[model samples]
Target: MWQNKFETRLELEPRPSRYLLIYQIVLHTLAGAALLLPLILPAGVAFVLLATAGGSLLWQVWRHYREGRGTTRLIWRTDGAWDYQIGVQYWPDLSLLPSTYITRGLIILHLQPVKGRRLYRVLLPDSLPKEQWHLLWLRLRYAGFSEEDVGVKG
Candidate 1:
């Protein structure tokens, strides 16, 4: 049996990648278009939908910016436990292994907390060396997650 000696620490400060910027622009544009639906549909119904969608979009954007602006610290202990902290917020210990989603040059970590799931998006900027990114991924995989837990966007 192979005993794993896992002890690593990583600090990540994600920047806005071009792909992320484009995606955000497209998403906000779609939401803006939905706001015009009141012209076609019943005013009351359209207003409700518009409000819901707009609020949801704004909330998502706010959360994204908040997560991206800070330095996220991840620690993998030899005891097979993980610690994640962003800014002053210390997230609860991950009850379940995280799933990874790769899309448009961004890697998203979907962490299953005690309650629901939370997403941490890492925007891969061109300035970041590919070697470092590979090392980070390898460390994450070695910590326990497997390829089966990864999903790639088409």
Candidate 2:
């Protein structure tokens, strides 16, 4: 779960349908190294890189925790009264042809604060199960976005 707003007493938690645990483990391990490796480096340079990676990792962890705790959601909430959200499912050969792999379907979300316009995008990867993709879409839409509000161009 995740939320964009810190106030208003609202929290959103959205678990990764897949890769959730693996992602957490990898991120935590890298963060741990970043925090620990600086002790061996030459102080000046090591400290910088360590600080950058470790700090980022720590923050990511905090975000993940907050999301899990229903304190935040993945939806981008802007102070400008604008919000936008999108999800993408990478294909098996995403590394080979990054752009054209979503030949079957794509999913996206777009919003225009000034224009009050919302968009939806759905792009299906050949590798993804059609039923799972639909379920994911349904979940996303129920989280406060319209099916037509998300787009896939970007």
Best by TM-score: 1
Write the residue-wise lDDT of candidate 2 on 47-144 in tens digits: 67767766776776675565444421333333213232323321110011112212124443232333323333223333235664554444444543
All models: lDDT?
0.58, 0.39
TM-score of each: 0.58, 0.36
User: What is candidate 1's lDDT per residue for 7-26, written digit by digit as tens?
Assistant: 55444444446566567758
| Candidate 1: residue 40 Cα off by (Å) | 6.1
**How well does model 2 score by local distance difference test?**
0.39
Relative to the unseen true structure, what is the C-alpha lDDT of residue 38 in candidate 1, on a scale of 0 to 100? Answer: 43
Least accurate stretch of 10 residues (summed lDDT) in model 1?
Answer: 1-10
Error of 2 at 77 (Å): 19
Error of 2 at 110 (Å): 2.6
